[model samples]
Target: MAHCKTSLAAFIFSSSTDQWLAAPSKDLSGLALDKHDLEEMSVAQHYIPKRHYAYGCFYWDWVQFGIKKLLLLDTTNMEFSTADLPPGEWSKQGIAIVEAGEGRLGMFGFHSETSSDLSYTVARNKGESPSQWQMEKTMSLDSGYKYCIRDATQRYFLFTRVEASTSLENRLVVGYFSMDIKTLQLQRVYEKQYYSQYQSYTYINFPPSLLSSRRI
Candidate 1:
């Protein structure tokens, strides 16, 4: 899967095996959003394995792109659609997608302020109907200054936190935490602290097939 930025073109490569193909590019004339809107912002897409679908977030912010809306792909029907995010003040850093309880896809967004609870918009079931999307749950991540959810499940969730600092430093007082993925209650069970420095950070969870299969 790749995005064509030169033109209003995006692509999906379908093959039985992990074979390469030279797919011809074409403008996204009518798919997803309008052509004019597509030209305005680049799409940052992520594949949700549990749902067998993917979504694209429009790039609007520099440090954290695509904070406003998202474009969704229905793999079962091979159709493109747009969906509105949950109502709340969201940060690019705190915004993420996780597998909520019952293997439902959940849109995780946090409040701008640290004192508030993290918002979660989950789909009612494993279907494409937008009406099924509802406010599933919310939880707190106030253990540290700032936090981001990396992955989640019905039993547990993984996240990282960056502590407050006085001066501009290249390093971050980082902490890794995992807690019971309960409804409105996160019972902490694992945690660790360390200092990490990187040019950029990307949170991703690879498929088990790719992780354990023969290395490419």
Candidate 2:
């Protein structure tokens, strides 16, 4: 397993050696990133807590001081790199990285508070051409309620709907739902009329066999 810090230093734990080893710095020249943008790079902050893993790499949504990009750590080579977000207005909204199956990376973006469509895009790389993002699917959501993406994993995303209000503190969470990335199925996980001071929520899905089996 590898861990990264703000300084871009990576440390890996080797089970065979039973020790933590520091990974060497990686060159970003081959990544095709602008020199100026590389200088301003920053890792994900506390507000963005979710980390995505796919294609032998771990990804984190990084945005700091107007610099927005995906910080990638390739576990196979123990190197760190960055990938630009998908183009368009959706990139400015709340987005989460997801595995799109078959060694592809997918992203889910909320289409503002008024829009009912949630945009899903996947990265496409063909031949020697640069990788680009292409729209895959747009899942329609209830426009009546305001939704906020809380967390995302391999194939499931956790989101909450809160009562629309001018003040953030006065807003009340009314519904919580988890959406399956593959099936595009929305499952209501929790619903209640309550005020929550917590800023984050985590959704855990257990396999059906485990849920039905008797506890020892």
**lDDT per residue (tens digit) for residues 1-216 in model 1:** 345553322345557766654434434454455544554444533322112222322211211443344545544444445554555566655455555655565665665635446676887775433345687666655654666555544345555666645233644646555555345455443354544544323334557865764211
- Per-residue lDDT tens digits of candidate 2, residues 1-216? 233233455677789989988888655444456656545442322244347666677776643324446767778777767777777544332567777876778888765555657888888962112168898988787767677777777768777877655357777788878888899888998887766676665635557666764211
Per-residue error for 54 in candidate 2, Å, reads 1.4
Segments of candidate 1 deviating more than 4 angstroms = 6-18, 21-40, 43-63, 99-104, 113-116, 124-126, 129-133, 152-156, 166-168, 179-196, 199-216
- Identify the candidate with maximal TM-score: 2
Q: Would you list the C-alpha lDDT of every candidate in the order shown?
A: 0.49, 0.65
Instruction: Provide backbone clash counts, one per model.
Output: 1, 0
Which portions of model 2 miss their true places by more than 4 Å? 1-6, 13-18, 25-49, 63-68, 91-93, 126-130, 201-216
How far in Å is the alpha carbon of 22 misplaced in model 1? 7.3
